[model samples]
Target chain A: MEKMLAEKPVNVNEEGYLLEFAQWDKDIANAIAVEEKVELRDDHWKAIEWIQSEFKKDSPLSIRGIKNSGALNIKEFYELFPGGPLKKASKIAGIPKPKSCI
Target chain B: MKNLIILGAGTSGTMMANHLVSKLPKQEWNITIVDQYKTHYYQPGFLFLPFDIYKEQDVKKEGKKFIPKGVNYIQKKIEKILPKENKVQLENETIPYDLLIVATGSKIAPQETEGMNGPNWHKNIFDFYTYEGSLALRNKLRDWKGGKLVIHITEMPIKCPVAPLEFAFLADTYFRKKGMRDKVDITYVTPLSGAFTKPKATAALHYLLEEKGIKEVIDFNIDRVDYENNKIIDYADTEVEYDLLVTTPTNMGDDLIKRSEMGDQLNFIPTNKATLQSLENENIFVIGDASNIPASKAGSVAHFEAEILTENIQNYIKGKELKEEFDGHANCFIETGNGKALLIDFNYEQEPVQGSFPFAAIGPLSLLKESKLNHMGKLAFRWIYWNMLIKGIPIPFVTAKMTKKGKQITI
Candidate 1:
């Protein structure tokens, strides 16, 4: 495997999900989203913002939680991140991977 | 007392044993469940093994543990089923039955595809249907540095139809996390015209595939697997090359069904789709993947069919009309990776629609929509399968019949 060196190194799990929530920032989140091939729109930013806040509060992050948070509806949430909405949204939001994501 | 023999001590067979043990009169009938193996595998857990979401021990349990107290559990390979004589031929002896339940579920036949079982069988070509196959694939993925990964389904009627789609989605997430998403060229190949069997779900899934940057090759009937060339050839002579192939090979009923000459061309016993009764034999009933029904060949279908079949079996014993009719009620949680999943509930007449499930307006779970709750539901199902389902304990609110109460019909 080729060495993955970043200017601002981030600790991630074997599957690449974020391990430490405190280490996340806008630059790292943007980089992750770019790798996921998702162009972050305004709504995407809202999802990321909500997820990060929820993580800070130690609240459960879910599709329903996102929808209930008024950040995105079910269709809009799926449209914003496509496949694996919670996983991708969490990654881009710079939060630890959800327990159910495995 | 008369013998009521059940073939295959798998999911359906075990469930039937638990159900009939309490319902049937022990004085008039003796319940017996037969199989060749002693381990009962939670088959759905196989889908998560390749991704390391589930471990080997999580999906396996002692088969005898689930067999009810009053029922006789026999561990023997069935040689053949003599339906005419109302007897089953085992390796050493023959056992006669007044009533028989065929629950010998389907098996993946990799050899049916040319070159599939060749030198690259477990090396580059792997199937996640079996326990060993899933483990091998997991080991292979650990060192795989991302190349052309193709997930293909050879034919339809495979157990858990949405599993391949789940694999594709999970692989995308897996590679992305491995920091090699750009290096891997992921593709999903299927015999169907769309990503799934149903129409509405197909459209939604197609969009998800495009969003994930995973190429989808549909309606491509695979004719052969070119192992040396590392390519899969379709009947139309189209070639799809792959560095690694995760395939769901042609799934067929047990070999005993074929030897007995009581099954269709695919070794599935022909049965009344509504009644679950064998078409050629009155005393025989086929459940799970062993039946040639229009419904999806899935565990949920079998779970629903068992409820109806149990009632019908009781009715048969009492010389009463078999009034229970199964409407092919099936529900599945489609795992879309990254900790989110979608729930779908439908029957023979209605396709999956976007709506709340079990209730019309108040749904803790959404239908046809991906959610974290659905993912939790999928994960929690493992516990339910082991405890409630096989024990014949009725799940509250979720009945065998499909209801339109919470479903919105969409054209």
Candidate 2:
């Protein structure tokens, strides 16, 4: 129910995960993060940036990827974004919801 | 022709029906499966229903669809099992069997816990084990703002032991997505001192709880549900309050088992864990959640037990020694939320260890480690459950027995 700054209508799935990757921006990420109760600390930005870049390169983003990406380890990634680190981080980073999430 | 009657056309019953029809000569054996309900629910899917990960259609199918053509599928309420006479009494009929398979799986009994069925039930208190309970909890969660979301287990030996933890993890993700993570206070209350029964897995899962910021209330043996006050009081007088209580109530075997006086205190048939043969009666074999085995009451355990039981049943019919022995083998995927899950495979003797599964050092799925591939594997299981498992078709790599080939014993 939170508003995003997208000029075109931003479409999301039933769970509020963005359906379109092109509609994502830092503003949208901030808005989503705020709704998620995340303050977007440096470590959080590092993970978000890594996932976004991985998406652009067409590489699969995973827990192992985040661990090996040197951006964050498994423990830190979970601390930065508790519960669902990869799914939540990916959503904020503007990627399609991963198929494995369900 | 001799009759081999199986009670409850659920997971084990359906699988036994499919497995036996092919092995037992139709000229000499008549296979019949009886249950009270016409629909068979994929019980594992109930864990996802509360999170909206699985819909009703995904988990439900006609019970008769999976039963083979040669077998007789009866839909009737079982009155009692006269094991001494080798007969099962239905409401209107008394069916005789040369051999009987007690697959009348367990059920969640909220009434066993005082005050659990009070006014708050289905309003503020809910369970996700049954179809109706899951559906009700799903609707309640959709518009639920934020409050104390407590996940409690009334006791152990419940079906799918890891489901409560999975529910808590999913709830955390659900609330985070709804932008109310901060508004919600999540707590996990269990009878065990840690997240799981196994120590190694507990250490790993305990870290997951801390990482998620979910508080743990361990060693809380629930004595009663103070429903009006929205509190659960343990035997030690310890109380935990909650706005929404999602609990796994006390699980027990079917009421018929209790009436027959053929089961343990919990109504679970006392069976030889290795042989699957009833300790009380030789003609009766207990499988799945019906047996009082130390193993987890899970579908995978049932599948494994069925393999051994099928062979034992054949041996019994042939007047040969029952040679097959079941080793409490069970494997399950623990959904950790955020598109990742963990896999654990073990048996009665061995606990889950950190290693690759099915292949050594080159696993597409990692054991005791969270990965997206495991999550994908878990999701794909829904398809397998419908198509292959119930049909008695063997999965490519996994077998009935637990293997240490790919597992790391040193931990």
Candidate 3:
């Protein structure tokens, strides 16, 4: 069933981290997915929260619509975290990067 | 031996009254202030009213609350200014003054624009400049589930140029929280081709607008408001249908200025931008929104003018040359929602440049850059405006002259 679900490939290469830690990832991802909110995996959560708190020079929530100003870019993030999407890792870490960005 | 009479008890007048009443010896010169309304509104507070951030009572208080004991307040409508005689005609009596200071501020004259005051004036169309309109729109927004909510500017030369953009940002946050972010579609319309008056500011603001998914209708000349058809028609006949329309109407000077043929066609008092003295007559002086000074007519500009005009008046009385020291200085706090804001400081000779404020190379507030510290300053100003600014207590190092101390280098 996991293989069949993985074959669909609905999200992207950027979200591959969920596949690596599929065993424990289900708990946090479920909470985020159920609320229709963006979920950050444990490691990814650290980056997003850090960027919002320290890296962001503008306002606190100013990272909302800004581009490339995020904790990690999708392309670089995907290359660095080949085993799993940082978002999945970020969520496990309790970080939330809004999926609202274009 | 001569008395000083100030017109309009708005922000500029209130400040001048406080400034002069404190400095001028009580028996030496009598100060009289005139206005039709007795309510003194925290004008900046009006921007937060519709969002429930500021309530009706929070922004409004009696005019006398801020006025000092020695200063006399007259609640009466001004009929006309006979500058040749140096007197102002009120409803039942005439006021003669040795020196007249015009601080009559501007107002939202939706009636002057075609089709603006039609059947749909406040029903489908609304303005947040007045207390009544803000409260009315707040109610409409509360029950509003979502549709095409368009924030528009009818024309240029509007007060608080950055406000409409802030309103759009807040509305986006408001809708998303109600679980209706997907249900609402927001659009921002402006008369300028850019999102803001200054180009650099526009580029920064434009990026935010795009990020928030707010559509931009640039260079739109609002020809008329078709209330029955539920659309705003542009000069070229382009139209945007809206379930709800919020706008900043064309601001005009006092009615007396228009009636007496002493102001521009839009009712703005004609004046020397450099000296802050009225052009209609030599003895009359204008400040704040009343003066037709092609600049952003904000409260900070008035504060800058107050510093110069108070001295200029003394110079005039001392039989000295009227100094040409007035340069339009306006600084504002732009709220970007989510507990952060932007602080911009600019003047007539210079557009807004990114730099630190109050000190050279060391500032708690950075210009052009956004920070949570700026947001705190924006929030703390309300207390300062009421207790410090209006009472004429000087803010350290924030003198009228624009210093380049904390300003960034232009390499």
lDDT of 2 at B186: 97
Q: State fnat for each of the candidate structures.
A: 0.00, 0.00, 0.00
For model 2, residues B1-411, the per-residue Cα lDDT tens digits are: 899999999999999998999999989999999999989999999989988899999999998899999999889999999988889999999999999999999999999788998888899999999999999999999999879999998765688888888999899898998899999999999765456645467666667888899998875667789987899987556799999999999888999999899876567888888899988898999999998877888999998888888999999888899865788889788899988999988886677888898788888789999999999999999999999998998878887899897787762
Residue B325 lDDT, candidate 1, scale 0-100: 82
Local lDDT at B320 for model 3: 89
lDDT agreement with native, every candidate = 0.83, 0.84, 0.71
Descending-lDDT candidate ranking:
2, 1, 3
- Kindly report which residue pairs in candidate 1 clash with one another: A101-B339
Taking the tens digit of each residue's C-alpha lDDT, what string does model 1 give over B1-411? 899999999889999998899898889999989999989999999988888888889999999999989888889899999988999999999999999999999999998888998999989999999999999999999889878999998875677878888999999888888899999999999765457545467655557788789898865667789998999987556799999999999888999999999876567888888889988998999999998886778889999999999999988888988854899899889888789999999887677888897678888889998899999999999999999998889887898999998887743
**TM-score between model 2 and native:** 0.80
DockQ-based CAPRI category assigned to the predicted complex of candidate 2: incorrect
- C-alpha TM-score for every candidate: 0.80, 0.80, 0.78
Query: What local lDDT score does residue B404 receive in model 3, on the 0 to 100 scale?
Result: 61
- Please give the TM-score for the first chain of candidate 1: 0.84
Please give, for residues B99-188, the per-residue lDDT of candidate 3 as tens digits: 889888888989856777888877778998888888888888888878888899876566787888878887887887788979888988
Each prediction's RMSD to truth: 18.0, 18.6, 18.3
